[model samples]
Target: MIFDKLKKFDIVFDSPEMDCPPVFSSGDVVSGKVVLELSAESKVESLKLHAEGFAKVHWTESRSAGSSTAYTQNYSDEVEYLNRREVLLQADNGELTVLSAGRHEYPFSFQLPEETLVTSFEGKHGSIRYWVKVKLHRPWATVKKIKKEFTVIEPIDINTPSLLAPQAGTKEKMARTWYRSCGQVSITAKIDRKGYTPGEVIPVFAEFDNSTSRSVVPKAYITQTQTFIARGTMKQKRAVVATLCGDIVGGNRRETWHGRAIKIPPVGPSILQCRIIKVEYMLRVCVDVPGTSKLSLEFPLVMGTIPLHPFGSRTSSVSSQYSVNIEWLRMAIPEQPEPPPDYSSVVSEEEAVQNSTEVQPEEDLSGVLQRSLMAYVQEFRLRPPPVYSEVDPNPQPFAMRPRCMTC
Candidate 1:
């Protein structure tokens, strides 16, 4: 039988000269060879190949229908980044081609599309994937098919002006009881920079104050947010990627973190070049109290393929003319791990802290905290027009010459 004669069929990629795992990016040429080994002769009509890259998101959420009945809502969307096809071998006029071969190799190459592509990622509800497939057609036998997947990485440097800027936020929440208030909880947190690569350490400094009757614990988390949009609606999923916990603070006590370290785990680079689906990261510092809702301060984070340059290497903010190192482009983008651990697992009694001050009304408190989150970032849209006194502070009392009568 043909199965006995056909020993092996496989595809292999050509290694780069640099030997850094032969990573690929947009507009790259991917060259590889298909190896076929057989002990006897074989006949085939054609061998063809197909390559494609795409991102897709799908998930179902449950909602109430009645007291016990529930209905499901599905959200799904997809984007195609590349598609290409090739014919490796074929009979000139659809005739079966005979091959008496012990070892055969068919080389192939593909030019990835120049369009922007999101890095390879695997998440709970979606994934960005790239792959190539091959088919071998025979006259009177079943067609043989094989597939292989590849990684696509888009470099993101951390030395840019926005990413290099420090991030900080402050939020306060009241600790209330049924009859009276138990004081308040507040948290102020800051990070040195926003952009980072996998395995890099984030330096988090924060102050936590607890005036509530209940003990408070301080915890930090690196979270991944996956957003999927369809039919004018959106669904989101958040997973905890990394976590840090601090000791408990009793009532009327405070705790300070001096550069508390949180190391980032292996994760895919940010996906900003795609539509319909977005992958984002953030740092959440929370103070867990005994009875009330946990108070949290959130700061956005950017995950990138390239690390920040060494200290003193960058004299100023990254300019448009700035270029990334070639070595970084050659490194493979990390594959995002399948759904991280649950967020509830990180909560512990010994790891809560809260800092609070007298603040009335929820909306006003949120506005004040958001306004105080970053001194450097200004959102004029969220802020009303500047308040000015009716009378000018410095009156420009220049005596204009009386010219109305003469004109």
Candidate 2:
């Protein structure tokens, strides 16, 4: 009977362009309409609209006591960026309003706060979201709610002098096992700039020198780290957004990457403004040696909303549609925690060697569908043998196959 009486109820957002999504930033005005359709006359109590934006992080960990007892602890935190409410329809002088309409529309508008806001983000254990909810209360019926979400993109300009600066780092790791010194491997790498946007290419130039007795494989990854802080403790989840690998270098051989490009996929802008949740990006160039820890070079990266100009001018470049859709951007992250090696802390003690294999990048990367399919292929790999491949004395660069190791 309720379904028969209520024909339709929906909330729709207005966009500047017909096909584009409604994307806003700090201090922006968001306007939308609520539609209702009724087949017969109905009595209404009150209608309210609420808009809110905040970052939330929650996860649970299990621990054991001295014996068989078990206990669970929760790590959670919240940081509010916005809270606004407005009344659309209400009772007049404590009297219920009776409506005899076939179709009704209620328009609402809310201006975001002037303070800076973090970009919209979704992660495994945490998320930063903005949404508007409508609540309808009736005399004898339970309250009904309708919610719609939006995307907020705070601009990060890569044209600034700070972001335009080049980043370079060099790190070396000794290859040793059980008090035996096989040798050492060191990497020197640099990126053209520290800031990049979606669809842009990062030119990686690096040199890997291996003096070990066994062969080594060189690789690069664009990693995204999601950090959640609560009660003075922090938890981090990583996802490999993009990957590129080089050829295998034989023992006592050298390897180099001359502007090997790693394209940035469509993802949310870096969320450095949020306190409870932080989204960071890093470019890692690593060496996978045998029977020892690998050497790596890391550089901080800023994913921005603005793209670099073709002629290096101040002219603005437009962002594509994929960047604004929060849902699509969430899909950019892998479902599983398919991250690369934790090069953050290399094997200082030469713990255990990790084996890796090669994965072929798709030939046609023209559309999102193909890129998503490529993502699945690159993340899953078979366990490698003692070495990735036989000692190719040549140690030539492998251009087509860019892989992410499963180990």
Candidate 3:
């Protein structure tokens, strides 16, 4: 049985054997079974063990100072993108056992903090590292420790400094912009039809250069503020060239706001307001800004509107195609609603009544008065009129006629 005396013990890891997920987002438990297999010819006093988890972040920034002819350089960490440390687990002496001869497997498991698993790692630079280490304590000069790179990833914790005022003085202040596209934005707009059939929705679309330092949150509006004479009836439609009520489609924010940062990364080259309702005879995009001047966007705006539909139904029935370019320049008009039109000047009740009576010809005085009474009759429409196109004479003219003419 001297072979039993040759038995010695060793520890091994399984979860992060090669590479591990730094933070296991799954609420499910993360565990590892440590197999304590004994050698055939080894004797062991006791197996004392512990597992420790660690995480860290790191980054570097380089700067250059220049002179008239030459420039010196310096290097340091970018303070804006700094790193932090977090302890994942510490299972100290969690497992200890006196060994019996031959080979055996011991399974060990541990639970990480609930909040730590779901905690965010946005916007932070450096690397997130994790691993499990086991130690074998003995009656010797040193304790053996085994370490491995279980997981590595960039932390998601990104943050920007808060400010009370807009950063306007210098580029350095505006450096808060995370990502900037060095390309130009292009825009092209068009209407679906060349001419409009009155009261019809005109489809408009804008294709533009999406390259920008900021993400585009685009809106559209239309207005009939300008008038073009119509061949038929003059019913015009107007809208604000830009409106924020539409949906955001085709693009995303360059950086997500994790609620921890004051400003988010810029995003752009997006397409918005593609719905039919957002379409109009003319269309324009109005960019909204938080701190930066929205006007800075070089607006080569493309505008077109749908043609009016033929006048028959309250709803537009015929659709004609129309296209026209509109120029949008800043104006100083009072931004208040235009006062309601002066109804007193446009129409009067007495004129309306006089026009109605004269338009219908009647043959007799009784017939002339009957038209007025029939207009108010509830069931008159269903019943046929007693007579049509009857003529009427003025009472004054009848009075002036001689007795012979009357006879």
C-alpha positional error of residue 88 in candidate 2 after TM-score superposition, expressed in Å? 0.9
Candidate 3, after superposition: displacement of residue 357 in Å? Answer: 80
Count of clashes in candidate 2: 0
Tens-digit lDDT string for candidate 1 (241-305):
67788789889987777557676755446777677667778888998655567678888898876
C-alpha TM-scores of all predictions: 0.72, 0.77, 0.27
Q: Is candidate 2 or candidate 3 better by lDDT?
A: 2
Model 2 C-alpha lDDT per residue in residues 284-393, reported as the tens digit of each score: 78887566555677789987766655455222233333324433453454342344334334323332122112111211112222232111101111121122223445
- Model 2 has an lDDT value of 0.68
- C-alpha root-mean-square deviation, candidate 2: 9.6
lDDT of 3 by residue, 236-268 (tens): 112232222223323322211111101000100
The segments of candidate 3 whose C-alpha lies over 4 angstroms from its true place after superposition are: 1-23, 40-55, 60-101, 116-125, 148-206, 209-407
Candidate 2: where are CA atoms >4 Å away?
A: 1-4, 177-182, 313-327, 333-407
User: Cα lDDT of all candidates, in order?
Assistant: 0.65, 0.68, 0.27
Give Cα distance to truth, residue 99, candidate 3, Å.
3.2
Q: How many clashes in each candidate? A: 13, 0, 52
- Per-prediction RMSD in angstroms? 14.4, 9.6, 32.5
- In TM-score terms, candidate 1 sits at 0.72
What order do candidates take by TM-score, descending?
Answer: 2, 1, 3
